[model samples]
Target: MPSMRTRPSRIVLIALLVVAALVLVAVVAVSAPILLHRSAGGSGQEIPASAVPETTARGADGRVRTLSAHDGDGPADLGAVAPGETLRIDGSGFDAGIGIYVAVCAIPASSEEKPGPCLGGIPEGAESGTVDESRLTSAWVTNDWAWRSFATHQYSDASEGSFSVTLTMPEPASTGLDCRETRCAIATRADHTAGSDRVQDMLLPAVYE
Candidate 1:
């Protein structure tokens, strides 16, 4: 019973509404994963500065990075850790813009040496169960666009450059490093994106039993 001219206007209004709804749906689809990822992990408590055996390193850029660990409900002694136990490592004062890898590695023989041949290699995803070996290592590189888009577990605070990851201590033999003969450590370094950069390199020495 409407005039022809009014019918066209009504159709146009309905079409606009439909377009708006589609746009909203698209936005949510893109944002939901990111939101969920950022919320997935527990934000661990800050390690006290006075904690014994805490390790600190200063990058060339002068950022003082600190690494510490917690075992079960107690603070872990960085100098001693049992193999195959879960340890929560907390790091701060890193350059969030630079990606980093945290793993158990051989303590480099010299300050100029890069830590590596680490346990668990590199993890493929941020979410648990997504990567079979993520239990032994973690990567935090929200600065990398591809990682940000695909990784479902946000392990680091992009703004503060701090991260908390729980790593299951691997057997010394599995790390390709002789922990009993050579020193081993929970170490961090620039991730593959900036593979040659060592400014983020730091280590918390640990001996496995």
Candidate 2:
């Protein structure tokens, strides 16, 4: 009993509803994994696992420069890994008799500029500025000379010889980082020992387990 004018209006309304539903589904599909990504702890909680938790960009030289593992030891020290793979740290010369900080920092494969910390869970718009690290549950800490300057949780009794730090690399989808970004494993002595901070930083390239 509807006239031609009403018929057209109803059709438009139905079409609009379909479009809205599609858009919602698309958004959810993209965000589901990120929303579910796991962290060593919950918000505002200190996640010290004894555990837990990009890709590539080049320099201007027309040559692609990649930073693999940088442990003073050798390449074999920092082996390659894949998404969701568990990385084993053979704490050979790291530290002993003291606590240490262990973490994994990653860059997404889609980043263009120099890759930096994996800063997930940071406040929106914080990346452009210094988002309080305490607020960022996913920032990667570098195990350089001053590495300790940035750690929150300290795992005691890190490997000096046979002890090891084991961590599972976060899956790209869960990390909300681009698939190609590089990931680095950093372990620094919690307290100064042997007159040195004794830092261990290694870059991990993708090579699936």
Candidate 3:
């Protein structure tokens, strides 16, 4: 019963509605993972303990870097992290001019091998300026233009390139490596901006029970 003029308008309206729905779906798909991470807990809470061990690595430039782990109360041992628990990692003596990625990864067969595939992957919020602390499993640190323009508020360091971040322990299955059976590590490496650079590479060995 609709006339030609009304029929065209109805078609256009339906097309617009479909486009809107698709956009919504895309937004949901992108946001769902971040939301799930945030809900997993362990963000800004203090690590549980009083003393933790520090691991150090020397870069090609002769500069030294360090990583320390902490549970919710205080310092914790890297060799005894609980699966699914939260940990705070602290870093120091890094190169401020270069960007780096801090993540939990499987230990390489040898020092020359690269570390990966890391747990929690890269955060979507890193691309944007907004970072959800509760969902911080892996972190990118840099003073580069992209970081300054986008992720400046998320993580940074002093002029000395010292920084700290917190992450939730991923299950052994998620890493595709049974950390209970094999060794894993909390590691740092050059970010994608300098993917092949190993000057910043470092590892703090870890084991989960």
Q: Please list the C-alpha lDDT of all candidates, in the order they appear.
A: 0.65, 0.35, 0.66
* Pairs of residues clashing in candidate 1: none
TM-scores, all candidates, are: 0.65, 0.29, 0.67
Q: Compare the candidates by lDDT and give the number of the best one.
A: 3
- After superposing candidate 1 on the true structure, give the runs of residues whose Cα lies further than 4 Å from its correct spot: 1-52, 124-129, 132-134, 137-141, 149-155
In terms of lDDT, model 3 sits at: 0.66
lDDT of 3 by residue, 50-143 (tens): 2235666555566667778887677777767766688888888777766678887776665555677777677666667677767676777777
Per-residue lDDT of candidate 2, residues 48-106 (tens digit): 22222211222222222122233234433333445444444433332233333333445
Model with the higher lDDT, candidate 1 or 3? 3
Candidate 3 matches the true fold with a TM-score of 0.67
Worst 10-residue lDDT window, candidate 1 = 38-47
Tell me the deviation in Å of residue 63 in model 3. 1.0
Ranking of all candidate structures by their TM-score, best first? 3, 1, 2
Write candidate 1's Cα lDDT for 1-209 as tens digits.
88889998999999999999999998776555444432111112222233244666555666777777888777787666777788888888777766677788776655555677787655655444365434655444445554555432344676667888778876676635677787777777766555656677777777776
